[model samples]
Each structure stands twice: as structure tokens, then as C-alpha cells.
Target: MLSQLTYLSFLAVFAGIPLSILVMGSVISRRGDHQPVRVQVGGVALMITLALGYTIPWDSYLIARGVWWYGEGVVTTRLWWMPLGEYLFIVAQTVLVSVWTFQYASVADPTVGHSWRDRLLGVVAGVAVGAVGVGLLLGPAETFYLGAILAWAGPVFALQWGVGLRYLLAIRRRIVVLVGVPVVYLSSIDRIAIAQGLWTISPTYSTGLTVGGLPIEEGLFFLVTSLFIVQALVLLRWVIARWG
Candidate 1:
């Protein structure tokens, strides 16, 4: 119960990131300053908003459509004025937004300062992780599961770009982003995958496993995939900084 509260708190902070950033951007833009911090925070907010923008509305639609039944046979029709689930869901929505915000922070390592090679490596790492996620983790692709996989996993990638850019910090970081991003991303997504049990063999390539409705490897896959994205974005920044 306490753990759930903590989780919800994280959600609230993450969900509010965009709003916070927007306010910050407005203030900073007024100052006529283009500080990287402000720009970065703004980018973070925009990315997060763009990323999770779809889920909240869709969830609302589902709730309204009577798609989500309930837990313990209790339908929370209202919590002080708003529907109970809706209220909880608003919190959930914020959390969903927040998770992606912190998750995608810029690579913190000094080594990831700015370099083309490292950034490119991050891209390679992200792609590799994404591929692995589509291949080994999910255990084969069934006609490109983007729409399905993306619904849950997209947020992670939104934030992983920093970590992915952090790829150049070391071979260890590279490997982690390459391998770990997908794992984390996939796991985050797999639980909500709402698929048929663990070992969700995507209709081919054999060998699969599942736990609580998603593949075991998926969580780890998400982690790696998100990191790679961070890495690639870092690289892009390096290029633009050099050329521009």
C-alpha cells in the first residue's frame, strides 16, 4: 500500500513536469535567455507531453466507454465529485507522464559531454536494443507490433535519449544502453501488455516466457531501448553543436 503511494507520488511529479516546464519556458523566454538548462528542460517537457499525450485521453475514453471494469467488484463512481477511477486515473496519468520525464534526462556522465562518435554509438545501441526487443525479448515479431507495443513502451524511449547519449561514457554504459534499455522499456510495457500470460511468443521463432501477462525479458528490453534513444539524441546534439 505504501509502495503504491510512493509510486503515485512519482507519477504526480512526472505528470506535472510539462506544466512546470511550460511555466519555466515562458519565464525564461521572457528573459531573452537561451540557456541550455532552460532549453533542455523545455525539451524534456515537450518530449514528455508529446509522448504520453495519447494515453491519458485514451484511458478516459475507455473509462467512459465502460471498457475498464473494476477491481474487487467495486465501481468507484465518484471521489468527491470526480469519478473514483477517474480521479485515481488522473493521478495515474500524471505518473505516466512523470515516469517518462525523469526517465529521459540527459546523460549525466562527463564523458558524454559532446562527441560525434559517442552519439553515433548511442544510435547504434538504441537500434540494436530495439531490434533485440522485437526479436528475442518479445520472441519474434507478428507483423510489426508498433501500435500495440508502442502504446505502453513509448514513454520510456521519450526519456532514454539522455542515457543512450550517455553511451559514450564507457563501454559499460554502451552495453547497458544497448542491452539494458530494451529490457527496462519492455518490462514496463509487458505488464500492461495485457497479453496472454508470460512467454508471449509472438506467433513464431519459438522459445518464449511470460509472467503476469507479459514476457519476462520485456522489462529489461525497455530499459535498454530507452537508453539507446538518449544516446542517439546526445549524438545529434554534438553534430549540431559542431556544425551550427
Candidate 2:
């Protein structure tokens, strides 16, 4: 069962392969609009690095503290409290989201511009999330799952808004659709995985809330992750255009 769970984990990550191929291939087909695939590829690499760098420690802490764990006999290998599939999940999700955002952004053809409105919105958003995150951290220990998630993701969300808020604001609609569609789609997949006993979350450590059998924290995880990848792409596009 453990090996089977490990295989299921592998299957989840492997799903990204065909997803990436399809989205990236579409971008290539419309190269006239999505020219400079290098930018998209470069951005994907960068986000993957950043996502893994951040998520590994965050996830490691959770696993170490028993906030979540794979079902019995479900993990075949471990690297410092994390299953190998987790690392792959970070990369796979980063690539999947980045490529999807890039492909769609190309189609949207948004005019990127920085403005005071953008900065203002960024600061406001950052402060809001940071405040919530801090509040959660200072709250009950049983809320560790929520607190940890917000504590980590809130700052990143705020930072992206502060740095690339305008670019994101410029492409807000696309980002919404890009992030929204996948959040819902992937949330369902996640619910199924949980139901199948691929992994288990501690109800005591969570709000015990379920959306389609997935803990709300788990849904927020995907939501924040998608947002991070999309915003990272926006920031990368700006950097490449400015410095590349």
C-alpha cells in the first residue's frame, strides 16, 4: 500500500508532463504570439527553483510536526521527512502553472505598465495577508496548518503584489481565469487523492473544513501556489523585457 501510494504520488507528478507538453506545444504553435519561448522556459525554471526552495522547508516542517502524513505503507522513500514525490510535485506544479500562465498571457496580450494604483493595491494586499498570517501564527497551536500556510504564503503574496502588482493587475483577468480554473480542477483531483488515502491531513491541526472532501487549507495551498507561479511569470516577463 505504501508503494502503491508512492506510485500514485508519482502518477500525480507525471500528469504534469502531458499537461506541460500540451500547453507549451500550443504556445509553440502560436509562436508568433508567444514568441521568445525562451522567456517562458526561463520563467518556468526560475519559478520551479523558487517554489521548491520555499515549499520544501515549509512542507518538511509540517511533515516533521505531523501536520500531514502519507497513509500507512504509502511512502517508499524519504529525504529528510519529505517523500521524493513531494519534490517532484513542487517542480511539476511550478512548471504546469507557469506554462499555463505564459500561454494564456500570450493570448491575452496585456499591456504591462506600473502605476501608483498598482503599488497601492500591492501594499494594501500585502498588509492584509501579512496581518492575517501573523494573527494565525499567534493563534492556537491546533490551527498550525492554517497558520503555517498563511504565514508562508501571505508574505510571498504580498511581496509579489508589491513588486509586480501592476503587471499582475494589468493581466488580472487572465490571472484569475488561469488560477481559478486550475484551482477548482486540481482541488477536485486533490480531494480524490485524499479520499484514496494517498495522504492524510490531521483534522486536529486543521479547521476540519472540507470542500469536496478536501480540507480548506489544502484548497488554499493550491490557490496560493497558482497565484505565486502566475505572478512570478509576470515579474519575469517584466525583467526579461527590461534587462534581457
Candidate 3:
């Protein structure tokens, strides 16, 4: 039974993830009348930039290592199904989260010129969401990476972008900001993971680490990929409540 299941799992990993993302992404893209070409472009750009940026050095490092022994086939991370499953995961994850949070962008009331009360609400909201989301979906390893994306990214983005608006207001203008941070941080985690084989989308993805009866990849994955979907869901909920 176990062997049969493993075979099926492997088959799904090889066949499933990438295909679904393409379909889902397109469907979601067309849902909004006001959607911009740039959002789609940005997604492409992010995937390319991140994939190239990460894969280049990762391949290089793997090559540099005595033997990468890499090959292409269905690899099961068990979190999702597909070859380069993480890519599809990232893309689908990105779109959903961006769109979801983008929903919150409706709250700003552009005529207001940004309100501190709202900002405080956003911070409180984001933090509350982060904490609660973290609590519901999180565990120890995940607590670190996902937490970083959710809690810290908002403030970090505010500083970098000079976003003087409150959190809710910021969402109103665009929840893309909310989406971007988690995406970037998650992408970073993936890049690092692939390079180190902390977790993998392909059969050959691996690193020489294991702990507490789990692959290092899983531990790292626990920290990274799990919350991506949740963050997207939460942001989307917030956005819909505000906008819809």
C-alpha cells in the first residue's frame, strides 16, 4: 500500500502542479475588469527574475559540489503535485495572495489622503491576522519564515516604499504591497532551499541535512512554503471584506 501510494504521489508530482497553475492563473487574471497589464507583467517578471536569479547560482553551486546528481522527474514534496512543483506553487501562490490582498486596496477612500486611524487599524489588522494566521496554520519551523514575511514585511515595505498611508489605506490603494513582501521572502527562502536542497520540486532536489526525523528540506519548507497559501487567503479575505 505504501509503495503504491508513493508511486502515485510521484506520478502526481511529475504531472500535476505546473499544469494546474497555468490554468488557475489565467482564470484568476481575468476576474477583475480593472486589472492592469502590469500586474500580469510583474508576475512574469517576478517568476523569471526569481527563477533565473535563484536557479543560476543554485545550478552553479550544485555543479561545484562534487556531484549534483540532478535529474528531471516527478519529485514529491507532498505539499503539492508537479514537477518544478514549487514554481507553480509560487506563481499560483503569488497571484492568489496578490489578488486577495489587492481586494483590501478598496478601503483607502482616496479622497481622504490617508488616515492615521486607518493606518493603525491596518497595522493592528495585519498584525492580528499575522498572529492569528500564524497560530492557526503554523508550527515551530514555519513560525520563523512565514512570521518574518507577515509581521516584518509590512513595516519593512512601508519604510522602503515611503508608504505614509495606514495599513488599511495602503491596501485600498493596492494590496500588492501586502502580497509583495510575502512573495519576496518566500521566494528568497525557496532560492536558498533549492541551492541547498533544503526542499525540492524535482526528484533530485536535496541537501545533506535532516533533523528530528524530517528532511532538512521539509523543515525549511515548513518554515517557508506552508504559509504562502494562507497569507494569500487571509489577504484576500481582508481585501474582499474591505472592497467587496
Q: Model 2 scores what on Cα lDDT?
A: 0.75
Q: How do all the candidates rank in terms of TM-score, highest first?
A: 2, 1, 3
* lDDT digits (tens) for residues 13-115 of candidate 3: 4334543654466567654335454643454455445434433443344334422232233244433222344444445444444443433333323333435
Off by over 4 Å in 2: 1-14, 17-28, 31-33, 107-112, 239-244
Local distance difference test, each candidate: 0.41, 0.75, 0.40
The estimated TM-scores of all candidates read 0.37, 0.86, 0.34
Q: On a 0 to 1 TM-score scale, where does candidate 3 land against the true structure?
A: 0.34
Using TM-score as the measure, which candidate wins? Answer: 2
Residue-pair clashes per candidate: 46, 2, 9
Model 1 RMSD in Å is 10.1
**What is the Cα-based lDDT of residue 187 in candidate 3?**
50
Provide the lowest-lDDT 10-residue window in model 2: 1-10
How many clashes in candidate 2? 2
The weakest ten consecutive residues by lDDT in model 1 span 192-201
Lowest lDDT 10-mer window, candidate 3? Answer: 156-165
Per-residue CA lDDT of model 2 for 187-244, tens digit only, reads 8767866877888898778988877678999999899888888777767666566555
**Candidate 3: clashing pairs of residues:** 13-82, 17-81, 100-236, 103-239, 104-239, 105-171, 105-172, 119-166, 198-217
